[model samples]
Target: MSLRTKFMLALLFTGLAAVAMVGGLAYAGMTKKVDSLRRERAAEHFHASVTAYLAQYGSWEANRGKQGFDAFMRSRGPLAGDRPPPPDDERRPPPPGAGRPEPRGEPPYHFILADQEYRVLLGAGVYKHGELLPEAARKNAQAVEVNGRVVAYVSPEGVITPSRQELQYLAAMRDALWFGVAGAAVLALVLGVLLSRGLGRTLGHLTGAVRAMHGGSLLQRVPVESKDEVAELAAAFNAMSEKLARTHEELNASHQTILTQAEQMRELSVRDALTKLHNRRHFDEQACTLFSHAVRHKRPLSMVIGDIDFFKKINDQFSHATGDAVLRQVGEILRSHMRLSDLVARYGGEEFVIAFPETELPQAAALCDKLRAMIEAFPWHQVHPELKVTMSMGVYADLAAGTAEAMLQKADALLYRAKETGRNRVCFAA
Candidate 1:
């Protein structure tokens, strides 16, 4: 069942059990007490009457058998309900709520009168007249004394009929007990609903938040509506969720930073530090890919290796700073002049390499010669009056060279031939 229902049931059962046990015990004890009081009153009244009868008649011998005693008992009103009330002049009005007059019926209490020798004179239906009373009954007999001497003993032992007021009292207690049980049940239900609403609401919020977090939204909050342990639990859960969300955010930010740094590190690994050009290793790896594609498709691919003429002497004479500037400018020029499909990189000191896909040998030679002219024509006077720069380039276009590495070697050999021919020139084999 629901939490509220379960709580209500538990509380209700507990209340009912408590009320039942206590009420039952009280009723039983009160019943026993009332029965004892009734028997005491009956015994006292009977004892006095018996003592008066004996005192007036002088002894048990005055009344031989039950016939004389019955006559005496009839005069004295032996049965309470059997006699009419005494004349108004002689009788006082009974107290209110004490009880109504007893109905004419068998009396609940029976008294057996015994003399000092323990012979029964009045059995009240339990023994024959003049019979010896039982030992067990004799133990409970109360002494009836008249004029400072023991007269007789009477034992009052029988079912006790409760008075109307007594019945009313017991009934009132029983009704109150039932009322208390009902009241307890109502209180339990009310408390169950009130308590369960707060607890269930908080738990519902927590469940929803956990599901949302599982779905990738890491942030959540729940209400803390009480100071009880359940509320503390909710508060703890909220704190834990907040911490988890914060931790997840931090982790994501760290992950992004790591990715950015990794990209920068990878770019640095493949780039020439001075000119920011593709280094020989990156170029070589890419050139192999390009060569594979060209050979597979039987497409045009041109390879070129270029060297700055007398680069050592220029660095030696113009200072290495100027040589670096020259190299930076040349790399930028080549990068700008090439198609997006072309690959270019600084091969080593004062040397550059290029790969032109979808380009024939003649077109490659023309582009290289143009590069040579541009280098020779640049404003050398700006660096130093005596400084001059030129470049020699060699181009080769042949898939028969096998791997890109072998093709690059052929281009290098051609580059040596160009330098052998003269500085500031382009050479190719068609």
Candidate 2:
């Protein structure tokens, strides 16, 4: 069951138990009080009957055989609910001085009368007329006397039965107690339900906030609607959500910064600082990969290694800055003639390398010639009024130079041959 139901049940049970206990105790106490009062009344009646009998008859012997005892008993009211017993041996008269027997079953409460010698005369509560009283019963006997001589003893037995009013009072008390208990239980149940609902509503807000946060809404917050502990918890949760949101933003910013730095580091590692072309290390790595793929796939692959002709003369005659400008231009010319599948790198000072995938020796030689012409036609006079520049290139294609270093070395040898033959020309191995 839900907490609300459990709480209501608990309160109801407690109220019922308390009420039941109190009712039981109250009933017991009232029963005892009523019983005491009844016993006192029965004892009083016993004493009054004995005194009147003694005043009229003088003694049990004086009143015998004349119906004096029967007359006296009949004169008294009923002893509890017992009626007088039938005359003893009605067909025969009592011997000159005998008294009538007291009845049996005296309504659960009556008096027993006996002479001073403890010879019982009238029995009470199911006792025979002449039966000797037990010590337990005799213990409560009261002696009646005249002229300093004990005449008779009266013993009360079960004389504490409650009267009608007393019984009704006890019953009413029980009913009232039970009614109050039921009322208290109902009240407790109502109060418990109210308390549980109040708690449930407060906790619901926090629960909703938590669910939202689980769904990736880190900014979700609970509202503090009261000054109770639940409201305090909501306030704490909102604060925590805000902290989480801020932390998420800070982490995202840090991640972006790290990515930018990583990209810059990667570019610096592979690119030449001056010409902005792929450096020698990047060329070696890429060349090996392309060469292996081409050989394995039986595809055409070519290499063109070029050198700036009279590069040292340009630097010596004018300035190194002019030579650097010319080198930058050379990189631009190589890029212009290259496709996306080609790799171009500054191999070293005044030397450049280019690799072309899916290209034959003849096709590479034609591209290299184009590049040489472009460099020769560029306005090198911008750096110096008289400075001019050109490049010689060599092409090697479809050769099984197993490694990148081997392929580059073979192409460099071809470039040396082209420069020796003439400047500003392209040469290729068939």
lDDT per prediction?
0.83, 0.80
Please list the residue runs of candidate 1 whose C-alpha ends up more than 4 Å from where it truly belongs after superposition.
1-104, 109-171, 195-257, 288-303, 356-373, 394-402, 423-430
What is every candidate's alpha-carbon RMSD to the true fold? 7.8, 8.3
Q: Candidate 2, overall lDDT?
A: 0.80
Instruction: Looking at model 2, report the run of 10 residues with the lowest lDDT sum.
Output: 101-110
Tell me model 1's lDDT, rounded to 2 decimals.
Answer: 0.83
Best by TM-score: 2
User: 136-196 in candidate 1: lDDT tens per residue?
Assistant: 9988988878788887888875445565566788899889878877887788778877777
List the candidate 2 regions with Cα displacement exceeding 4 Å.
Answer: 1-181, 295-298
Q: Report the error of model 2 at residue 199, Å.
A: 3.0
